[model samples]
Target: MSKVVLVTGGSSGIGKAIGEFLQNKGFVVYGTSRNPSNYKNSKFPLVALDVTKSNSITQCVEEVLIRTSRIDVLINNAGAGITGPIEEIPEEEIKRNFETNFFGPLNVIKAILPEMRKQGSGIIINITSIAGYMGLPYRGIYSASKGALELITEAYRMELKPFNIDMVNVAPGDFATNIASGRYHAPAKEDSPYHPNYANVLKMMDDHVDDGSDPKQMAQAILRIINTSKPKIHYKVGAFMQKFSIVLKRILPDNIYEKLLMNHYKL
Candidate 1:
């Protein structure tokens, strides 16, 4: 039987691309959306899911297992975006971002582990962000949440090794998607100290997405990883500079790397 793949937040964006690509490649693909009815035209089946809610996660996983009897791959792609100066972003918004980007994926993994363990095999891929590798101005909250997931996956890999289960992180740079429409932007108040800079950064961030690479590239990269027998713990898919930025951070002096990012963002 073809592998059964579950992609969270798969109704659109990177998740959608991955789901469609996998389905075309002969895998049984199931994507999740908060309101599955909204995606009646989705290429693959979409089950209702609100990653931040435990009951929703449980129901979605159970429903998939009931139909497929096994889940060979779990893609933790559901995430939220947040942008604002760390101090300016409301505490609740920060918590909510974590609830979606970090806790949500972690919980989904928890929900699926038992079934995978029973099957004696599985691969879990966490869709993180290139932004997670560094603290970007105005996007600090998003960076922190995704970065935390990256670390958590590293820990999970070791713990799941004996069970023949694999976990990996795939960090993508900007991709042309509707993510900006849903992203939480802490209002850039004209009276506030960060007014103009924050506003400019927000615009720049949106433009980057507007000009980003095709989401299909991400789908292809994921397909390659899924086919590998021993996948690496982390894989990054994006433009040269975006992937290179992570390398720069590792070798460049801390102050120098920070300067580069500041210059890039024109901060």
Candidate 2:
């Protein structure tokens, strides 16, 4: 039998690519989105799921159970972004960012844990980003959301180990996606601090996403995880050059690492 898998935000971009890839591999793919979707055709089921809302998430899971009666894998990929200076960002926007990026996965994890625990077998993959590891200008809120998610994924992995359920985190570097285009673009509020450098920071973010790696490559990485029997708990994907930043952080002096970032990102 094909393994049953559930993916959130599978309507487009990386999620969409993943759903297509897994379907071709013969897995029963159920992609979740907040809004109704018909893009995946009749072969794959595209279920409506809004991670921010408990009721919405619960209903989606129930629907999946009603259809397939089992879930072997879960991928929490639904997320949003917020861009602006840390000081100028509104408190409510930060909360919203966390709601979709962090708590969204938390809710999905909660919904699936019971079933996975009872079965004593399952894998959960959380789609995070390099921003989760290192903070960057104009993306404080987005980075914080991913950083929180990284810690949450690690803690959950430890907690679920006893249940025989595995948790994995996939942190990808810049990927070409509509997410960058739709970032919550809030310039410095009038009379707020950080008026200077706001445009430059946002511009850099824009440029990175515009020319980043293709979404299909990320789909391939997700496929690699699902097909592997002993799937790794964490997978980092991106240009090998990204390793330089990781190395700089680990080996270079603090001042030197900071300078490297400034020189690299043109900050």
Candidate 3:
């Protein structure tokens, strides 16, 4: 039988690209969107799912299993971003950011792991970000969400090793996508102290995404990862400079790295 693949947030952007790529590779792909009807014309079948809600995740998995009988791979790609100064970002906004980016994936994983454990084999891939390594200016909540997922992925890898399950964290620096249009902007008052720099830095971040590598490249990298019998625990996909930035962080002192980051973002 062909392998079954489940991808969350598969309606558009990187998730959609990965779904299409894997479908073409002959896997039985079931992509999820809160409103599957939105992607009725998509190549792969769309399953209704809202990762933030536990019941929605359970139902989505059940629906997929009814058709495919088994799931061989699960890709946690659903996420959202909140950009603004930390002080200006409301508590609810931070919680919502984590809801979609971190907790959403956790909910899906919990729902799927039972079957994976039953089969004694499966692969789980968490789509993280380069920003996860360190908090980013004007996007602290978004970075924190991804960082939380990264750490969860690390722990799950070790715990699931004996169950014949594999876990991976795919950290993309930036990918040309519609993410900018989807991101939430923290309310900034006219008299807010960080107003001047917040607007410029947020625009800079969006522009960085616009100039990022092709999503198809990220899709291809994911395919390669899926094919590996024993994939690495972590993978970085992006430009040389972006990937090197992570390396620099590891080798540089905190004071120096902080300066480099501030300069690079023009903060």
Each model's C-alpha lDDT? 0.96, 0.83, 0.91
Q: List the residue pairs that clash in candidate 3.
A: none
TM-score of 1: 0.99
Write one digit per residue (lDDT tens) for candidate 3, span 154-217.
9989999999999999999889899989899986666889977888887788888899889999
Among these predicted structures, which one has the highest TM-score? 1
Please give the clash total of every predicted structure, in order: 0, 0, 0
Indicate the worst ten consecutive residues by lDDT in candidate 2.
35-44
Q: Write the per-residue lDDT of candidate 1 for residues 1-267, one digit (tens) a residue.
A: 899999999999999999999999999999999999998899999999999999999999999999999999999999999999899888999999999999999999999999999999999999999999999999988999999999999999999999999999999999999999999999999998998999999999999999999999999999999999999999999999999999999999999999999999888
lDDT of candidate 1?
0.96
Q: Write the per-residue lDDT of candidate 2 for residues 38-127, one digit (tens) a residue.
A: 564634678998898999999999999889888999989999989987776788988888999999899999999998888889899999
Worst 10-residue lDDT window for candidate 3 reads 187-196
Off-target runs (Cα >4 Å) in candidate 1 are none
- Give each prediction's root-mean-square deviation over alpha carbons: 0.6, 2.0, 0.9
Q: Which has the greatest lDDT?
A: 1
lDDT of 1 at 135: 90
Off by over 4 Å in 2: 37-43, 188-196
Listed in order, each prediction's TM-score against the native is 0.99, 0.93, 0.98
